[model samples]
Target: MNTAKQRKASLPERGFAWAAAFLLALFLVASLFSLLAVQVMTSAGLHTGTATNDSVLDGQMKIIHNYIGVLADAYGFEAETVRQSVSRDELRDFNLNAAAWWTGVLAEGESRTIPRWYSPAMEQAIRNAVDSAGTGEDPNVILAEITEKIDRTVYPLRESLLTTGLDFVNKRADIPGIVRSLRQVPPLCLVLCILAAGLIALLAAREVFSSLKYYGTALAGAGLVLAAAGIIYAVMQLKAMLSQASANLADEFGTMMHTLFLEAGGAAAVLLLAGFACLFIYRNRFEKHMAPGEEQAA
Candidate 1:
């Protein structure tokens, strides 16, 4: 009669324990994925890699040269002469600076005007061309005209090249607020996961080995799901799914996605290993300490 009453009481506790374990699994997966996302989104190295991609920089320089060609045709200046003024090295330095500035903006939500290094370089090139050609006109007057044209034409192109498409989203949504919420998600999920874990332990207080089994099951379940997802994503070709309007953009997005999945996979592996270790300890060590009948029941 006493054993029957004990079993009856344990039924409710076991039910609660199962529920907590399920919640723990769910929260574990959520926290892991959210943490990976936050890290990828705010990674400076990733941003800089995208910014300094060879194809992207090459494309920007090509457009700039094309604009200079148009200006040369209109103002009777040599296109090559102006193009030669800004060396590839100078353009590379400008991009490096721009990447640093963009990284800061993403992190701090502080805005700064992008420097117009190209404008000065192009303007001086035009002035040199006029002087070399012996145009007999005041170089300053010609410089002013070309400078105005550069402001109207090349400046917009420069802005487009250097931008990471955030401005478009910022205009439509509260990006800073969204980022703040994203930053908070992982820690919030972690706290809830801990609470669930604690609840499971409390519910199974009299059955310590049972709590270990529950924890092992929860962690293993979550790890398996996360790992499978990460592997699937890593193998999938994301570039085809992304907007092909800009090849450079697609490449960068793919790179970021790759990093995210790799981290997820790594985290999942750790969780899976830990879960298995717990289960192994419970089976080998804890079960041996139980009475023959209790061990058989377990």
Candidate 2:
């Protein structure tokens, strides 16, 4: 009983186990956080939130917004011209019936207009764009004009519309939520990492070489997991890129995304290698694998 009591008390003289566990946890989390950040930076739709330089979907979003805006202005002008001949009440009645029918026909997630301005005033001041798209002189010319008008009116709101892109607005609800959650991780992990490192250093000072084997194993496992994950993700990205239909997509954005995945994988690989080395050097308490001065470190 006396001997066991002395051993237990001696264990407190070595708080290195807690220190090792914390440090290991922090390192693994940091690698994961870096990988997630890389993923966000590489995606144009996602990068805006992280302040990553992006050319991906930002330009496209502006073009689409402008294209729709031009059509809206043209439709408004046409309707205003029509209202010049018709009485106000006639326009009101027509608008009410048309809006009711259009709204009734709309399926879930299908929006007739942005901002959904179905008010009487807007209705009277709007041409029936959906009904009159192809009923004009030279449909090709009309399309070209609309496209040009939109190009002229392009306004970029990329940074502000990171999670509000067309894809998400159309019902990728999960994406916005995931991004919001991920954006908070790096800072949280950083705090945890610093805390863990400080505690580990303190414990290490208190009990040198006390928990080397445990730390070594934990680090090695973390590294292996990270490396394996990165390798798998890189392979999957390569396969997906190969399968894409558009050449430009496959070559440009797809390649960029793939590269980002690989970068994550690379980070994971570094962690994995470091873990393996730690484990190898701390295989046993005997310190047989330690370098000349490494035992002092332990």
- Candidate 1 C-alpha lDDT tens digits along 171-225: 7878788777788999999999999999988987775666877899889889998
- The candidate that achieves the highest lDDT relative to the unseen native structure: 1
User: Could you tell me which residue pairs clash in candidate 2?
Assistant: 209-298, 223-272
Model 2 earns a TM-score of: 0.41
Task: Judge candidate 2 against the unseen true structure and give its global Cα lDDT, from 0 to 1.
Answer: 0.45
Each candidate: RMSD to true structure?
A: 6.8, 14.2
Q: Which 10 consecutive residues of model 1 have the lowest summed lDDT?
A: 1-10
Q: Count residue pairs with overlapping backbones in model 1.
A: 0
The C-alpha stretches of model 1 lying farther than 4 A from their native spots are: 1-9, 52-92, 104-112, 115-175, 231-237, 290-298
The digit string of per-residue lDDT tens for model 2 on 1-298 reads 1111111214653456565565666566575756466354333333222122233234333443445466546643343332333333432343344334222222122333321112343333233433454344343343455434322222122222432453466574554355556656676766765565555555555334434544555566666666666666667766455546433233334535555656666765676666566666545644554565666776
Tell me each candidate's TM-score: 0.64, 0.41
